[model samples]
Target chain A: MALPITSKKAIREWKLYIFVLPSLLMVGTFAYFPAASAAYYSFFEWAGGDAKQLIGIENFRRAFSDQVLLDSFATVSVLIVFNLFKMIPSILLAVLIHRLRSDRWQYVYRVLLVVPMIVPGLVTLFIWKFFLDPNLGVLNGVLEFTGAKSVLVSLDHFFGWGVFFANVPIGWLSQPQLILPSLFLWGFPWIGAVGVLIFLAGLQSIGQDVYEAAELDGVGPFKKFLYIELPLILTQVRLSLVLLVIGTVGGYGLQLQLLNEYGGPDGRGMVPGLWMYNRAFYAGEFGYACAIGMILFVFILALTFVNNRYVRIDK
Target chain B: MSACPVSAASPAPRSNARRDWAKHAIILFFILIELFPLYMMFQVSFKDTTTFIRQPWLPTNPLNWHWENWTFALRLILPYIANTVLVAVTGTVCSLVFAIFGAYFFARYRMPFSRILWAAFLVLMLMPSVVNITPLFILLKSLKLVNTLWALIFVGIAAGQVFTIFVLRNFLEDLPRDLFEAAEMDGASHLQQVVNIVIPMSGSIIGTLGILAFLNMWNDFLLPLIVLRDKELFTLGVGLIYLDGEYVKQWGQIMAAYFVASIPLIVLFLFTMRLFVRGLSVGAIKG
Candidate 1:
């Protein structure tokens, strides 16, 4: 029912154009301009300052042969896989909350689920960094107190893993071998509060009649989940998957903060985004950084496309 | 409240109650595990370094609470917190204002090329900002805005536009058109119509969007890190990172700083918990 502004009566009301002008101007100047500039500068030999030259495909060519960049992508791929597994806890918690018989309890549980999120994500990252400190961390303290350290030592002896030794604190973030494990250990329980609520929102739309019908068919709890709950929430699951992929690929905050810009030890913690950051800021290779960014964009775009095309189920 | 019909209709109320307890127990177990880290943070915030080292697991004794840690952290991070509030509030308000106007334009009229304009915004949503950071820094520097809080505010407003407009346009479209029509009949200008009709009608949604945008700006680190070069301009995220990088690690003071950085958000979330959750779910469903 939108009235076309080209209509005779609406044409005179040209002032209506004023509504969108601010948005267009702001986005054009900040968002679009920078993006267009990135594409342009990717082909240059600029060092992020005044000096520049037309490098023509040279930056992209170097990116193609860049082992460090490729290895960073590999590290991200492993993290993405771990994140995919981490989604299970959130889904299970959502299903549990959705199945609660009392609405009051459901609200209480939901509020409690959101409580931990009040702390900004940056704060949580730092707290985890504190916990992962080898000598003075709660993680090592708990391991030693619970005798898990001794078990890990024996296993290290059996497996000849030099990372874990007796009477020595395991350098979780510092050691090359344990970098990925430390990253995975972050945000333990990983019951992403927002993720659970999204899945719960999806679950709430399921009618009571559906549950009754399933019960009549003698569908047990596990079978009910397989047949009904999971299917109903597949849309939300797909959405989370797409976002997780995008975030994991582009996110470098954790690595930049927890590990050094050099990516610690054998560069095991290096992610593509961090590599781009290091290139531009540390190495003064703005052109190469832009190329890396383009590579990340294409990679994320393709992953999102595949997710939408394959994992989709209309609810 | 969809207790299985079989269980509800049957005569086994006691076991049903027992099963409810089991469910609650399972939920509480997960909740406790999730809350452990936060609990540890709060407990350790009140302990000095020596106390933390000696009794890492136990709670700080009431007689020996290190109030100095809190005071020291506040003295150090208070300026950062103030800067964040100024930037987040101004940025969120400006972004929401612009978004409301733009969403109204998109929702109310279909002009020539309006669809194309809307499509441009949609494309912006999919375009990653990673590539743009270096150029954005250059852009801001060219405008002589870098290293100032204005840079963060402007970029925050710009980065927030697409999502806000997208969500608001949907909400505005679903609004009862008759209200706007009546406002037009009353000889209200479009701006007046927005102030009288749209703002009142969509207060909750606007509030939700505002909180979400504010949260994003508050926790933002990357843009501020790249743009700002001065310690005086550091937001909480960057400020905390610098604090952490100091050679002599004071765990107590550092944890206290984390708590200080989070207090404002915690206070805000306490009051707007429902709206915040609703906003997130709306975003999830619509994004």
Candidate 2:
């Protein structure tokens, strides 16, 4: 049947548009317009003020050749790998929590895990920094109690193969090579709280009847999870993956907090986001920062698109 | 391991004992790991710089317990806390009002451009905030809102409203049409129906979105960093960053500040965790 399009309908439509106008205007002015400008700014060379010059593709060319930019990209790649290592355990822990029958225990676990997330990032960083402090850290205290020769192990001996059989002193964050791993260790404990929340939500959305049906078919817990739960929760997984990728690529506030804005020792923890900030604000390389940001944005967009596609297929 | 078929009755006492131990151990392990740093922060916050440097792990022998640190940190942090609360609450209220109306329209009224608007929202969700940061900075400057808390609030409201609207619309759209029709037969105006029916029914979802928004704004660093230049107008996140930079190597003092800064958020999270979890599950399913 054809729908009627009378004057009343037109009037109602106008009212609806008017109602949504404020939100639309806000998004357009603050979000969409700036996004468009960010893309445009990438193509030109402009500082803070009206003083501008058009240097077409030169900014991009400089970005490509910049050693710091390349290092930042390498740093983000390593962060992504570490993030996956964190995410897997987080999901499993969330599943285990969901399976627990006791509501009191579940609630206790939830609150305990989430306590880390609620703690301000700087506080967590400070605590971990102290905990991992070479001379007086609790970690070293534990190490010494376990009969280690030196609390602060040298990086070479620590990373070397024979360290397992011998006491080898290592500087976790002070050493350039070990900085990424140290940062990961500091960051990983907080993931379980957020991941568990997201995964628990995903778990509840997977209807019980589907699980019951799988059970009736003599499917074990492992097989049921593989065949049913995994596919159903792909959307949540995709959402989290996209967030993680964007976060790792952006490497903005979190890394700055963890590394105290100088990046890790020897700039080993310089992610693209901080590099952009350093260039634009610290070094006043506005054009170069914009170019790097544009590239990073494109990378994140592509990753998000791929994630959406995978999510759709899984659904 | 032997595979034993379990009856509908209770399990063996030995197995129950083992299971109880496992559960307790698991819970204790995670709780200790998660809360250890927080506990350590508390302990260190009480000690002076000398004590902290001397023995970072253990409590100070003298047990200084510098209650003055809290006062100092509070004095420094109160204005920032006020600014943060103002930004978060105002932004959340603004977004909620806009989203409730927009979502209701999308759910009930068949408009010509509804689908297009929805599609636009979906795309906007994928656009990272960093993509807009530079442009937003310029825009806020042009509006003469830089160095102001309002700039942070407005930008946050704008950036955050889309997701809330999407979630709210999905939820309201799934409401049974019969209820709306029943309300219509009772001579209810659109406004009346929304006020009398939709708002009341959406309590849980709204609370969830509000908590989420509040948490996001409270923890946000970038927007406040770009917009608010005055130290007095800084949010906690940005304030902590500034504090870290300005204090030099006073790690103990900084950690003390960090601990005090986290208390409000931690309290808020604990109080609303159940609702927060429920909201996530509902919003996820609907989305």
Candidate 3:
């Protein structure tokens, strides 16, 4: 029997709210409340857990004039350029795996590819630091073995930028000149299991009829990739791009600082997130840290809005 | 880069063989790049500290290898593994339980402010979690949870639950109405219908979500770093950092510790890639 539309019906509908209430309370306390409080803290001048006073945007004004903060933005921009380009390998690996004729080969590649994902990211970074070490590095060893060290020296002299030095020993993690470039080169070949899986899923959704039609016109592999696969997988590509943009710009730069390296080599590798963290935890300037965080949030929020508007895969 | 000639219906047999070789070569090259660093760490874990420093790339002489690193590293950090599992499991279970209740209700009922609340949750899901650090630390410290696993568990259950709820809610929304309607026709109450219909229907999704939450919490470095302080309370992520500090000059020991940190997740992935891949491919990372 259908229940009449009355107080009973209203009570049942509202009963569901009880189920949602705990979740709401938890999220409100942890995520939403913190976010709101972050905004509120931005206007105060508090330090070392002492009594506070209203600062009235002083921290933000300081953010504008802060040279270190400005340089961090530039450093992040350069790092982001490399991060964006890293998507190419992810796409390429996805395509290669998709094109494999054998099911066993596809399974093998998928399983093998996940190896990198399981390893801790920081461990991989640690290994890369060792791999690129100037004195004891594998990369430099290869250069010496191949007798390309002399060529690198000549090239470094020709460029006059100290950008390429094989025999002269490049400082991969030190030397402000090379640190950003070294950071850019982080996550070399950058294809992770998630990226490949996302792209493969996108590629698998394409109809065979489209490829068959192209084949009839004698479109080869390269043509098929360019005209068919690339366009079709634009959504997946966009998804990866937006994620990379956010991760590089807002999320990971703080990680570099947390490693206790702060800004590598004369502050060339500084980022706003790290600066915010330094202010809050190190300097005990919680209010200023919140203000700095608000500045970074504005940039991230703007980028996220732009990405959602322009780069949604579902569209 | 050239397309096939218009006159040709198919490539020549010799060129076909050549093409296969080229594709295989390229695939093999990428695979090596993927596997090389991992292999480097694994191989170096067998060397003595002195040998590793003097001849960094030398092949480990099986006879001369120092296997003590594994024993040494594990002895130091196995407690952290246990701690990590305790926190990760509790956080994941709580997240799943809360998500199941919240997602099912949100899916089945249109209560007041539900849409607005869900929209706000969605926006929070998209916002960079780095933004939450400053205030969350203060909040957790105020509650005296800073040096305990509960801090990570609570934060995870609160913030980490968004993805699980979003995924499960979408899955429930797509459920066939007839299934639940038939239950309603039988005079089953909403709770009974949910117990009978929703729980059983979402079994695979529950598996996917549970594994993802577990892995996410386990691999989490930042939250535990910010919250947990005592050496005894360190999860594997934080433990691995401390391991690095003690073994900074010992490549063999560091590599051993790294492998110790990596092995559990690797084992987990090997067994659960089917569910893991499904969870990943169905757009969990959309936000």
Candidate 4:
């Protein structure tokens, strides 16, 4: 039974395909093709050469066992933890802002919170770095004024504030232990800018009737949040989690800036993104870097899929 | 359920006072925490090394106001800003053009493989930028597009298309089908219909998409870092990093530079917050 196909229908279909062709070509050449090449490169030990030796799975094997890789994994895990800690509070703040009755006040807060997001990453990084500067930095000065020893030990030598406060400086950036936390402090406020915006959207979508019902039942604000608001906005929470996870794992560009591309103080703050970057560019370990990138891609894909499924189920 | 009497509905006066105090304290605490860092940045930007060290917490005495750092950082960063603007604006314009036409087709015609094409666009939207970095870098290098602003503009346009198309397609799909059918009945060509109808109706969506795309392109660091070898081609993100590395010890100047770089974005965000928020919510929630 041959299906009757009209010439008009066939021409219309062909025209549509023609319209989509340019976009497909662009995506294939720039995105899909490169993605496939990255996967292929992951399997062999080819370091920028016309001829390559085949080392099947050797690159992946080395990537798994490498100490630097392991360290980066641990660092990324810690970063994710800190990011959640920061992001949750920011979301709560956004919800609070949305709860305010005055639209004028809400706009003011939105503008202030959003300022950080617009700030160039370079500027934000430098401002925070200055704030934490051990010597002549404002943070140390505040600590000294509060009857505490200077946080920056180097400052004691330069300022000569007193012998009692002449201990080694906080060494915020130079110290490996402080590097991760310092980076978190520098980056956390910016998270609020985006988090508030997302949360504000979520809050608005929630039906006011739910809140009114809770109130009629003599429910407190906290109980209403737990029983209604929280459940309704779970989709936004999941989206945010997925975003934070990807950003944490795949975001090494900022670290390279703040930490001078060495992951700051013995590579304590080295993330997977930076690890892949250093491997490919600095060490010319193209195969290994691609393997790491593929692994990250798979992880992100799996997480996003899981998040989407979870959201669907909740709905 | 037991209902309380109307006379007993209100809380005790003492309890009300306590609740009011608690609310006020909590709000004040959070406001201070949020504003303090920004305040510190502003204060430090004006202070010299000695005074900043002597009283970091106190308001600047005599306000040294290092206006010179502004000029210095501007001298260092202006080229980068110009480059960023060029790439972001051009990329956004190209993306909008492709997305508008593509979305119009998807919404109007029930073409063969339409479902599959839509699904492909969605999947591409989920594909993270990190996954494409290495191959794209090599591809650009092979094309001899490295160190040029065009490399960034092209990539940005390509990368932004999927989401823009998705947003535009959704808006277009919600339009009345009869409107398009009537245009077709009047013998209007597809291009003419798009020009006469879709473009006019899509003003808000297009404007929103343009703003979002521009912001993303402006803030982007990784693509420029890889493709731009010449310092002059550096975007704001890369330029700031270069400046930071060069003057590692000059914390004041670095912060000052950051302050200057952030102002334009802040202004844009402040003025367009309502539109930005509305667009973000629509795109995010609908997806």
Candidate 5:
């Protein structure tokens, strides 16, 4: 043992690798190994077997031409549109809550907002699925009770003249045309609790002196928001934007539920991630799925990077 | 920064009483919107079939107090809950252990390849979960680990370590290093220091990370759905889906099932809400 004398420092540092190894191993197997394996598998064709044929970018070629992929892109654009729609309410609510007179009320609202997080997200979607049920939905009931349905019917009759659209008892999730807007309605008034709280944090962090300075200038609320508050909380907006991009693009929750094993009428509800999932496990096109995964990864990564560079609210 | 930084605190001036009322009203409206879906779920669970169908938005017959829905929902999902508990507990423990060790070293030590490795992990953390799903499914199948609670637990542990490690590393870095150095000067071994000093001070974060991990595993749907096919083997997430499959769009029953699945997390949230909110806000701000 004395023959090879290692310094205590060397031993101290070397032992650190032991601590590092378990994490690396876990992450390697699940995160890196799969990522690497996905990249590797994208080059080969396999259907749940050892025998893999070299496809040589055939999957990528097909993916571009695939009708499902094209349709998904279209649907994703719609999703993106609604996503932007969703952010406005979220930001407005954040502002509203942040302006509360009482800290106790603010605390109550904060807790109330986050209480929903305890419910599984998928379960929430399922609950909304019920709410979107054409026949027995509360929304339709509310429309009936409040006579909004009749108002809508008359408005549709006046506006459309039976040319393009009409008021109908719509199956929000099931209808091909209504899918996008219906999905929006399902998570309607989407005051994202996390978004609100994060914006509240950003709002709270704004220097009081900045506000006082703005007040001294006698700026109206709208002008103040446009000039001062907007600039200040732009960082939160950016963060929320990035998060939305990730959640919408990467998240399979909505598509997986609303579509419920298959894409909606005429594949209207299909998004890219769900399409990738279906291709992978259900279709057994491992190579194709991996290619899809890689494409999604690169797309999101590029989008995020571009946003960070060009669309930044804060440096 | 003294307490209440003058008129700058609230959004509107005190003199603008009308504006204050408007702001309060808007806040209430948004809160109602946020809570509406959840309210629908809870109120529906109490409604009888007819009442649920007719007056979902209205109050239920309070005297009736549909105990059957709770009983049915709880009974159906009890095994699933038990399975979830096993997975969540096992996964959370393993994740916390691995993260603690990794974070301690990453926080305290100056090691070769640390920067590169840390960067690699950071990049990996950012990579979307779906990107890894296909290959991971294959990997799991090949390892003959699919459809087991252990497999679910394994995946949870593996997936959760990234966040747990990131959070714990940041937390540990913020703590003063003097105590550890003192222990080292007293001829304390790394293990001894970790056991005595690190563990003693890390109760809150450990709790925070543990709850977060447990919540993640508990609420996970896609992974369990893909992995487990056997109804008995399924976790709550997958089980609830199968329940939904049986009763498509049955609001009361569906709501009941959801409430049952949600109870554990609700109780957990109740106890650890401060830590949970702080973790979320801090994570967002810092990231």
Candidate 6:
């Protein structure tokens, strides 16, 4: 039933191959070409114009010693840690929704969870920015209203933190020392709708018999979650973990929008992608930016490889 | 089997009710926390600056609600919304069309270099878009497509092809091969087979992928921000950013604009809620 390489049937089947051409062309021209050009242009001194001079490995050399770039990596590492902590709420929410006894209520909650996603992520970021506003933000209003401000003020006094004081509005996004914490505070109760749905899918696959077995063993809810549910959803967890790393590492839109081009006060919020954006756009160091991009590509590739290699789930 | 002490001869209905109440309270608490910002946004959208600052966390009186904020924001963002919808719809349709054909090829026939072609698409998924932004910008400029909606559509198509094709190919692969073979025996061309059989069989999937591609384009500001220099050509995402910068941070008007920007996707989701959920679950299973 197979056609040999030189057979007439294969020649006759050539027309079928036309189906793939358009996609290949689109991908080759738009996606692959730019990536290939990034590699090629990484060695040049181009300012995004006609004038470009070849300077092999110099761009990479500068990136190695760039203090801001190194610091940006450190900044992202902190955000990554915060993001890891953030994943827990989604898992918890999914488990909660999955365990609901009423099918009607379970369906209702799942739909409710997805409602937030209809709001564009950009709009959400801006809303959070408004929330972090020092003078008129809801966060500060609630803090002052609930007497949390007084507690924070007392704590600041005890610790000599100097950042919190009574009667003075706290600059959550403005003060350099507060930027990273402000980022963590963004997307509060971070039950990502999609993440929850994903984990729910995994959890729903557990047979009812498993739960009955657990019930027979007198296992409490906590132990049931630990022994049965957690293990079953570990596959989804690992997938999310890989995705989370790649997204956090490569993402700069949040920092770019919140902190501006230079990454806010003292560049406290700078990440590698934002730095690359700044270099290419503001500084006109397009070549060096490409080099930075290449470094990021390699780093992400290796990180993904290691993640898949080490984070094993016994299926 | 040994019954648990709790579930032995008679289960405690009262305790189960209490536990159910606790679960509902916990879930509701988290949901309230999650939805609080959006709730604040909606409430603030109806207030003037003075009212918003004074009553920062509460809804304004109905008589004092600033409907003009909505009117003004609607006027300002209407053009950007139109541009975004045009780009998203056109790009989604084109990319889906391309992906359908490409996916059909991979799913149906095993031709020479099929593995290489499939690998090419798969590899793009691993490559981060961040690394390609600068060079992609340059490539667009040289092609003289910078500042044009076509640039966004083209790039969206390219970026969308990999995922759409990957997912659709899997769907197509699972379709009964006999249906295709029967059609082929009737002297139907490949294009005809796709139109007659593939499209009809995979309508729901096509709809799902289209929504996803449309959403990706609608939310994407970075590419549009980089490519489009003209204010008139700005999509909603970039337009909102510019509006935020240009305005004096008027809370009511800005929040109203944000609300207006969110309406299209919300309406889309409302109508296609089931399809959207199924799409995501499908992706979850596959991923």
On DockQ, the candidate that comes out on top is 1
lDDT of 3 at B157: 88
Residues A1-315 of candidate 6: C-alpha lDDT, one tens digit per residue: 112244365578898788999999999999999999999999999998789999999999999999999999999999999999999999998887777665566777888887887888899888888888899877898899899999999999999988898989999988898999999988888888889888988887777677778887898899988998898899989988888999999999999998898999989999999999999999999999999999999999999999979997555
Give residue B194's error in model 4 in angstroms. 2.2
Q: How accurate is candidate 6 locally (lDDT)?
A: 0.87
Question: Which scores higher on TM-score, 4 or 5?
Answer: 5
Q: Give per-residue CA lDDT, model 1, range A62-123, as digits (tens).
A: 99899999899899999999999999999998898888776678889988888887887888
Runs in model 5 with CA error above 4 Å?
Answer: A1-8, A154-168, A312-315, B1-19, B247-250
Can you give the lDDT of residue A249 in candidate 4? 77
lDDT of 2 by residue, B27-132 (tens): 5676687888777877777777787777777776545687777778788888878878888899999988888887887788667777788788788877777656
lDDT of each: 0.87, 0.72, 0.77, 0.72, 0.78, 0.87
lDDT, model 3, position B262? 83
Cα lDDT of candidate 1 equals 0.87
Model 3 chain A lDDT-worst window of ten: A252-261
lDDT of 1 by residue, B213-270 (tens): 8988998998888888888889997898899889998788888888888899889988
* Chain B TM-score in each of the candidates: 0.94, 0.88, 0.88, 0.85, 0.89, 0.92
Candidate 6 has an fnat equal to: 0.54
Off by over 4 Å in 1: A313-315, B1-17
The DockQ-derived docking category for candidate 5 is acceptable
- What is the TM-score, restricted to chain A, for candidate 5? 0.90
**In model 5, what is the error at residue A304, expressed in angstroms?**
2.3
